[model samples]
Target: MNRDKVVLAYSGGLDTSVILKWLEIEHNLDVIAVCIDVGQEENFISVKNKALATGASKVYIIDVKEEFVSDYIFPTLKAGAVYEDKYLLGTSFARPLISKKLVEIAEKEGAVAIAHGATGKGNDQVRFEATIKALNPYLKIIAPWRQWNLKSREDCIDYAKKHNIPIPVTKEKIYSRDQNLWHISHEGGNLEDPWNEHDKDIYMMTVNPEDAPDKPTYIEIKFEKGIPVSIDGIKYSPANMIYKLNEIGGSNGIGIIDIVENRLVGMKSRGVYETPGGTILYEAHKTLEKLVLDRAVLSFKKMVSEKYAQLVYDGLWFTHLKNSLDKFVDNTQEVVSGTVKMKLYKGSCKSVATKSPNSLYNEAFVTFGEDDVYNQKDAEGFINLFTLPLTINAIMKKEKNEKEKQII
Candidate 1:
C-alpha cells in the first residue's frame, strides 16, 4: 500500500533530521523535505543530499532571499515594529514567509499534511501553525515536538546517532539557532539561565563590544519612502544592501540584544540575537522620519508601531488587522524619503545628521537668532487660553475650601 506523503520544513539541523527519520520509521509517511534559503550561510547541496539520504522521497531548496527582504523585512522596517522595543524582529517575520512557502510546496506536491520542528514552548510553533491554518485549514499539521517521546536535545542527538544521521549540534555545544540574511538567533543551552552572561563565542554576525575596534565607523543610509535604498551612495538589491550593512555594522559591534522576552505561549524566554544590519536600518529610518513626518503623525505612529510589533510577534501576520495596519504604515511612509548619516561606535549606533527634501522643519521658526517669523510676546495670549480650564478648576477648589472653613 502506498503511504500518504507529508511536506516537512527541513533545515537539515538536529531536530528536523531526527523528525525526518522518525516520520519514516514510525508514521510510515513518505516525506518531501523542503528547505528555504533566506540568505543564511549554509551548503544547500549538502542539505539536499542529507535529506534524501534520511529517506525523503524528494528535496527542494528555494531561494527566497530577495522576496523575504522586500516583502517581509521592508514592511516590518517601515512599521518600526520592534518586539518589546529591543528585538529587531528578525525571526518573528520570517516564519510567515516560510509557512506560506510550505503551503505552496505542499499543494504542488499533492501532500495532504505539513510538518515542522517547532517546539510547543516556543513562539515559532504558533507562528507556523497559525499561518498554515490561515492559508490552508484542510491540510493536516504535524508538530513532532508536541507529540514526540523525545524529551530533550540530548535525546535528539542520541536519536540521530542511532539512526546514523549526521547533525551539527552535540551535547557539548547544543545552542539551538536560526539563521537568515537579516539576523541569527541563539537559544537553549547557556541561554536558558537568565543570569548567565551570553558567551562572546556565540555571536556570528557581530563582534563583542569589548573586542570591537577603537575607532568609530561612519556611514550614510538613503531611503526611498521609508524603504532603505542605498548605503553610502551605493545602491544595491534588497538582499545585498542588508548583506553589506551586516558586514559594516558587525565590525563595529552594532547589534547584539540579550533579553528575557515574554513569549506568545505565556512564558518568558531568554535569547541572545545578533541583528547588526537591522539595528542600523531601524535607527536610520526613525531618524529620517524625524526630519520629514509631522509631530502629531510621528507620535501616533509610535503607538501604531508598538501594536504592529505585538501583532507580528504574536503570529497574527495574515489577519485583517495586520493588513489594515500595513495600509496606515504605508501612508505614513509617503513623506519618509531621506538620508540619515550615523556613527557606529562600540556597540552603539547613533544618528548624527538627517536631511530630506520633504522635511517639515522650518529654520526660521526654530532659530534662536532674531527673525521675522515670530514674536516672543504672542505666547502670552496662547498660554492664557490653554491654561483657562486649569485655572478655573483651581479657583473652584479654593472656593470650596473657603466655604468649608466658613461653616467650621
Candidate 2:
C-alpha cells in the first residue's frame, strides 16, 4: 500500500465518492478531493460535506465556470471544432481544463500523485491521463478502475454500501452522465444497447419537442471572433450569456442528439446529448462565418476544424500541433465580428439573417439580371482558357484518327 498523499478529482458523484474512500483503505493514502465547478448545476455545500464524510482529508471546490467559457469554449467555437459533424464537444472541452486544475492542486498540496475515478473502458480515462502527463510528466497517476478488481456499477454500489459511503447512483437511475454549462450527456444502462431508443425521461436540459410551446421564439446573437457576446441586443459576460441561452433554448426544445459514436478507445458508445446554449451558439457562429470568410479560407478552415476536433476529442491539447492550429483559428476570427438573428421553433433553430461589416458577399456583382458591376462578356475568354486542357486533348484525338484513316 502506497502511503503518499493523493489528490482525487471529485465530483460528489457515486464513482468519485467511492474512489475517495477506497483510496484511503486500499492505498493507505491521504486523499485531497478537488472539484472543478464548470457550471454543472450542483450544490457545492452538499458535495463538500459528502467528500469530508467519505474520508477526504480536505475538499477544494474551485469555481472555473467563467474561465471554462471564455478561455476553452470560445477558442473551440472559433476553431469550429465539432466532432463527427454532430457532437458540439461539450465534454471534450471541459476535460483538459479539469485536468489542469488537478496538476496545480497537487503541487500546492504537496501531493506526489493524482487520482481519478474514470473507468478503463471510456474516453475519459485517456483524457485524464494524457492531460496529467502533458502538464507534469513527473507526477504519478493513480487510476483506480484500471488497477482495481471492481468491474461494474453493481460492484461499486455494493462496495459503497459495505463501507457506509453515501453514493448517489442506484440500480434504477444507472445512466452515466456528465454536465457543464455547455451541455449534458447521458450514456450507459439502456444506452448501452444500440437498438434501445432514448425515452423522454433520459433528457434533462431540454423539453421534448412534442411538449415544447406552440409559439416560436425569436432571438439575436452577437459575436466577435465567434465568441457570443450578446443576446437580443443585451450584452452579457461569457458565462451569463451562455447560462441565459441554455434556459431559453431549453424551453424551446432546441438541442437534443441521439448518436452512436466511435470512442477513441476502439469501442462504439450510444448516448444522448442536451446542449441548448451550445446549439444556438454553433449555428450563429457558422452563419457569421459564411458572411465574412473568403471561399478558399472558409473551406480550408473546415479541414483544420476536422483535425482540431479529433485532437481535442482524443486528448492532445497541450502540444505544439494544437498550438499551431490555435494560431490559424485565431487569424480567421479577425473579421468574424457579426450578429445572427434566429428563430427557435420546437426543436429546430434556423438563422433568419446574418450581417457583418467585413462581409465578402457583394449583392450587385452576384445578381442574375443587368448587373453593371460584373461584365458577362468576360466569361467567354475565362471559359476558353479554363477548358484549354480538355480542348487540346480532343483536337489531338481527331488529328490522330484522320492520320490512321489515311494510313489504312
Candidate 3:
C-alpha cells in the first residue's frame, strides 16, 4: 500500500530537515522536498543529497534567482518599500514566491498537502500560508512547528540527532538566518534579548565597519525608468546587478541594521539584517527621484512607499490592492530614469551626485545670479496668491479681536 504524498518546502536547515522525518513518521506521508533557490550562497548538490538522505522520496531544487530579482526584488525597490524605514523586506517578499513555488510543485506532484518549517510565532507562517491560500485554496497546509511536540530549537536539535539527520546548526552556536540575493537576516539565540548586541563575527557577507577600507569606493549606477540598468557604464542582468553591488557594497561595510521590530504576529522580535546591495540601490534610486520627480509626486509617493512596505511586509503581495499600487508606482517611475554617483565608506552609502534627462530642477529658474528669466519680480504675486487664505484668516481674527475689546 502506498502512502499519501506531501510536498515540503525544504531548506536543508535544521527545522525543515527534522520536519521532513517527522512528516514521514507521524503523518505517514511520502515527503517530496522542494528547495527554491533565490540566490543564496548554498551548494545545491549538497542540499539535494541531504534532502534525499533525510528520507525524502524525491527532491526538486528550483533556481528562481533571476525571477526573484526581476519579479520580486526590483518591484519592491522601484516602490521604495522599506519596512519600518530600515528593513529591506528581503525575507518578507521571498516568502510569497517560495509559497507560490510550493503550490506549483504540490499540484504537479499530486501531493495531498503542502508542509513548511516556519514556526507558529513567526511572520513567515502567515506569509507562506497566505500566498498558498490565495494561489490555490484547495491544497492542505501543514505546519510542523504548530503540530509537533518539539518546543524550541534545543528540542529540534535533539530530534535531528536522534534521527541521525545532518543539521547545519548546533546548540553551541545557533542563529536563525535567512539569506538571499537581497539580504541576510539573523535572529534567535542572543538576538532574542533586545539589550544584547549582535556579534560582529556573525556577519557572512560584509565586513565590520571599523575594519572597512580607509578609502571610500565611488560608483555610478544608471537607471532606466526606476529600474537599475548599469553600474559604472557597464550593463548587467538583473541578478548580476545585485550580485555586483553586493560585492562592492559588502566590502565597504555598508547596510547593516539591528532593530527590535514589530512582527505581524503581535510580538516584537529583534533581528540584524545585512542588505548591502539593496541599501546602495535604494539610496541611489531615492537620489534619482529627488532630481527627476516633482514635489507633489514625490510627496505622495512617500505615503505610497510606506503602504507598499506594509503590504509586502504583511505578505499581501498577491492582493488586488497591491496590484493597483504597483500601477501607481510604475506611473511614478516613468520619469525616474537617471544616473546616481554613490559614495560608500565605513558602512555609509550616500548619493553624492545625480543627473537625469527628466530632471525637474531648473537651474536657470532658481539661480541667484542675474538672468534673462526675470523670476525676482514674479515672486511677489506668487507669494500673495499662495498666502491668500492665511491673510484672510488673520484679517478676520483682528476684526473679531477689535470688536471684543470695544464690547468689553
Q: Give lDDT tens digits, candidate 2, residues 245-301.
A: 999999999889998888999989898999998899888899899999999999999
Runs of candidate 1 with Cα error greater than 4 angstroms are: none
Better of 1 and 2 by TM-score: 1
**TM-score, cand. 2 vs. native:** 0.97
Candidate 2 pairs with clashing backbones: none
**Model 1, span 350-380: residue lDDT tens:** 9999999999999999999999989989999
At residue 81, give the lDDT of candidate 2.
Answer: 91
lDDT score for residue 118 of model 1: 95
Q: What Cα-based lDDT does every candidate model obtain?
A: 0.94, 0.91, 0.94
Determine which window of 10 residues in candidate 1 has minimal summed lDDT.
83-92
User: Could you tell me every candidate's TM-score relative to the true structure?
Assistant: 0.99, 0.97, 0.99
lDDT of 3 by residue, 1-408 (tens): 999999999989999999999999998999999999998899999999999999999999999999999999999999999989899999999999999999999999899899999999999999999999999999999998998899999999999999999888889898999999999999998888888878999998889999999999999999999999999999999999999999999999999999989999999999999999999999999999999888898899999999999999999999999999999999999999989999999999999999998989888887889889776878899999999999999999999999999999
Q: Show where candidate 3 strays beyond 4 Å.
A: none
